[model samples]
Target chain A: MAARKPIIGVMGPGRTEVHTEPVDKHVELALELGKQIAAHGWLLLTGGRNIGVMDAACRGAKSAGGTTIGILPGPDAMDISDAVDIPILTGLGSARDNINALSASVLVAVGMGPGTAAEVALALKARKPVVLLATNPEAEKFFSGLAPGLLHVAGDVEGAVTHVKGLLAAQQGGAAGGAEQQQQ
Target chain B: MAARKPIIGVMGPGRTEVHTEPVDKHVELALELGKQIAAHGWLLLTGGRNIGVMDAACRGAKSAGGTTIGILPGPDAMDISDAVDIPILTGLGSARDNINALSASVLVAVGMGPGTAAEVALALKARKPVVLLATNPEAEKFFSGLAPGLLHVAGDVEGAVTHVKGLLAAQQGGAAGGAEQQQQ
Candidate 1:
């Protein structure tokens, strides 16, 4: 079988949250994380808007010469960030968050807002590995009671990238086991 | 120009909410609303899942000999209701909710769960007219502060349909003005 390229989905605040100094810091964190993911030869997926953490991550991935896919909320390509290598216009609006969650083999949440929180919930529901980088109190509170193995809180880009790699390894291991079982 | 057929998006709870007596009432309401929408020559759109209010609405529309569209969350057609004439497999997951909201010229919200509430918010954000039938306190509270002209609270299927027709007329009037301006 051909080696599958991992797709990591990054979810965070959009332009509605405004670009304050604190918000800009979160965007920077997302950029570093995007760069690390691309360096590992993984594709990055985001909300595909030209604002907030999504744009930052897409820019970082592009700078690292990595392919990035933006799953857009509307059919119009105008809302897509220039850094995105591919734009998937779903026209699904906020519900598109589920696409962001399910499309990724693993998800990284940079900051929490209503939209981001919804994506995190969907990712958790799907039992996908979620790495949180500089999450807000609401996100911390939402995942507080969940089982620890599925959720990881990373304080830095390196830690987030490491967690993502470990999760990817575990996912590949499980897939291999399933394939073997089917063959048997 | 050909007269456009209005598409009405219906938002409600999913199967996870269970089909109990109370829940069934909501489904019945959705069914009646769907029938009324179809009878008015308008198309009905729902989440496309077979288990909850989505199924009921689709069934009602089909029974009324109306065309129905299901904006599915997942890529597979298996989850789509049999009564749906058209199944749009977005593979976008919950993000398909935005498609539902955006595709419809008007929206009918039967019950509000997190998913349904998100759709309502999206519809409102897009400036689409939304009709609430038997809305919960949360939904009622959410719309309480919005401009009265854009939101309608209907008690029955007839009332909902009436509100939809009125809104559609208002929309057409606005569109006609734009068309006239373009011609000039």
Candidate 2:
């Protein structure tokens, strides 16, 4: 289950067409984000596709020999990224976005699109912290307003990772405090 | 695995406090909606809690002698509704809402809240038709805008069931057309 280390969900937009694949700044950021997540000994969870941010992040994690879990939308490995170490075929379509949101202790979104936006919303609805990396200003503002302090806008990949760390630490601290209060 | 009949997810707000349980008009609508879904031989699914719309709908389904699946947030049956024939303990907290959204062939939300809003959003994002019985106007507008044709507003429980039937028929027709085109 790879529950040993904390899991960080890196969700973003994915393109199906090879020609439309924008290997731009966002893709670069996603790749670096995966490396940083792996370097910190955290598991990387993604949408598990062969193109766009999902593929780039998974490949980056694999390049560093880090574990990756890709929750695919379909119930097969037809479009799974080779870099994904564990591919879960849900057959639930985009609804699996909930699993991606809940499975991670903290979510780090590299870019914004309908898919990533849904994941971000689901994460926030579940009361999980989300670090948005270079997403558009509109999406940034919209999602941030949804859950207040649950949203963190990071300037870059490292900043996103840092936000992830801070958020996870805060959550753990809150959980511990709650446990203590319960005992009292 | 009750796949013989399509499953309809009935989601709405739930409260932990027994005294705060709102057995109001929305609860009545949800119960009637569940009965309508069962009368059509469709399976019903919910959050599987002891309070709120989830409990009311499941109880309604059981009164009609219909099978109900409850995807509980916790990993145990500590607060599961006795009316749920099958309980899926995900322990994913509110994240299980995604499964509720994905598992159902169609989603019928009788009221609106943060939890139900998330389910409605996820269902729309997945391109599934959702029938809103008596949700708020703001939620109705926001979710309807998210997916142009997927959001169906119904005035009452019977109207909601009618919308569900119409949407499912349209979906099947579209699928059939797509399959015919593929064959051609």
Candidate 3:
């Protein structure tokens, strides 16, 4: 049952609003991903705040009556967004590290900066499937040359979300196939 | 010249979506505030990202052709949304201190959680005008006991924006009056 609902962790800043571009597109894509995840009965984990893409994704999940989890750092000094259904305040030493380690079964990093790079590296070390959306080209150029296929790049939000969904489905199917063979 | 267009620091979380009790009310308020701020020719500073109220506010500011500044953290994260014209990455340091100690005319906090609380305290400590929207009950209780006119509370977005505009006007008038008295 737990395997059925794969957790999808989204990595980004928790308490800052960074809008270097039009946010509506990202907001739309995030909500769409949330809807798709809910439709597929998957869990959505994020840095929870009622602002930015985190809130947009949660709105999408809740609109579809899906369960969303927010890993918060503190209650008084820090917090998740208003859209979070479950707020887990872990007071972890490394804010991004804890969130990265707990985002989901497969991690998706969108619009990352310095803080999330270590999380991305951690995901790579863990051998977890990672999808990068609008990530730093320099970082990609550097990391891709270092280790090919460690990061999956997408052209846009649609491309990124679709690619991740496909990866998730394949993993689920492969796991089910193994279970069936064991039963036989 | 810098003082003429006083910087207004807007703080909130990134990547989270909002769903107010009545639905869309908070968003409407956030957008209205952005529009009002732009109309007043005030600079809008925020965490640049495409999500939640941040995006909405950016949209409003850009539509009005107002200058928007994104105070980003980290060296490689692309958290800036599309509407941002100027992007400043402040490395990995906590921006709370910088934002609170900002040379801004006023500080407006939208619907946010604990992260918003930290900024609110920072603004208060800096003796800046802080207007809080969608604040928690405990915060309201705390503010009520602070002083007679330290904080101004608004029920909705229009009220909040109007209240801030009024504050800005009064601040300008007081400064001008003081300048005249000094000359005499």
Candidate 4:
């Protein structure tokens, strides 16, 4: 029997709390990433927040009529995106980054920040592949050096989605991250 | 009533899976960090693994007759440290770093690695202070730049414990990470 639908985690910055303004490029990239993830018939996962990459991605996925699962930082539904169909509240605050990173078959980071970097690092630690989009060259270099095979730099959303598919296929072809595969 | 005893989480490389040989300095520092955390009348926390930093820290805490907790990556009691008084099986694999980062009053990273970097990043994302010991300068600079005042570079285990105490005091005095404070 086939395993459940692969959960693709989209991790990025939530500028509502950190930055005064939304990062337009990240929002744009994340929106496309969500659309691509949904178009592929994969499960889309993101942080259930009101603004920034999470909200934009959720919007894109919902626009495509795809189901989305959001991991909320607070216990109550404080600032969740309206598009999230399934909201998982951990009340773990920033530590909730772990849930976002661990739950995904592959994590696509559209932007770089303290939280997003943590998720990427955690995912790599579990031997999971992380596809980068719209992130700086410095971050790309640093993370790439840390995990040679697991880090993939993508030029755009389509490139990211392609790498995601390739990485997941690679995982299936080989017995990599035996414990991480059980996350779904 | 006052809050429960503060938990100091010790995070580092497991080494058994990733590396063949142990980094001696990290093991030595983590052992002392655990002892200092225990002696300060605070609780000790670590990954419930049999080798490397987790095991060494647990051993130090137990040696000092202190209460210790472990976050196990698997559901079953596999590769658990003998010194772990309370073992929480997460089955989260590398994502278990969130529990280690969030559950602590402060996290002391004895060494630098993919897993430890993620924990430090997660903790800082949640506005928790992290004390560093025996880590390379590049890792230190990277994390410090991300968190600013949240990062503390320690010369020794005793120094790390001091920073942990100071940071916790600052948290209580100020309203930093209000949501994170509710983690315990």
iRMS of each prediction in angstroms?
6.0, 3.5, 16.3, 2.1
Share of native C-alpha contacts between chains A and B (below 8 angstroms) recovered by candidate 4: 0.65
Show model 3 residue runs off by greater than 4 Å.
Answer: A1-184, B1-3, B18-25, B179-184
Write model 1 residue lDDT over B25-128, tens digit each, in one string.
78888888878877889989898888677888888888899999898888887777888889889886666666777899998888655567557656765667
What C-alpha RMSD separates each model from the true structure? 6.6, 5.2, 18.8, 4.9
Over A1-184, each residue of candidate 4 has an lDDT whose tens digit, in order, gives 9778889999898884323355488888888888888888998999989788998898888889889999998999988899899999888777677777778989999888788889899888877889989887767776887788889999988789889999888777765547665666
TM-score for chain B of each model, two decimals: 0.90, 0.90, 0.80, 0.89
Full-model lDDT for every candidate? 0.79, 0.81, 0.63, 0.84
Q: On DockQ, who's better, 1 or 2?
A: 2
Task: Please provide the root mean square deviation of candidate 2 (C-alpha atoms, Å).
Answer: 5.2
Which scores better on lDDT, 1 or 4?
4
Q: Using TM-score, rank the candidates from best to worst.
A: 4, 2, 1, 3
Q: What TM-score should be assigned to candidate 4?
A: 0.79
Number of the top-ranking candidate, with TM-score as the measure: 4
Q: After superposition, how far is residue B100 of candidate 1 from its true place, in Å?
A: 2.7
Candidate 4: what lDDT? 0.84
Query: In Å, what is the interface RMSD of model 4?
Result: 2.1
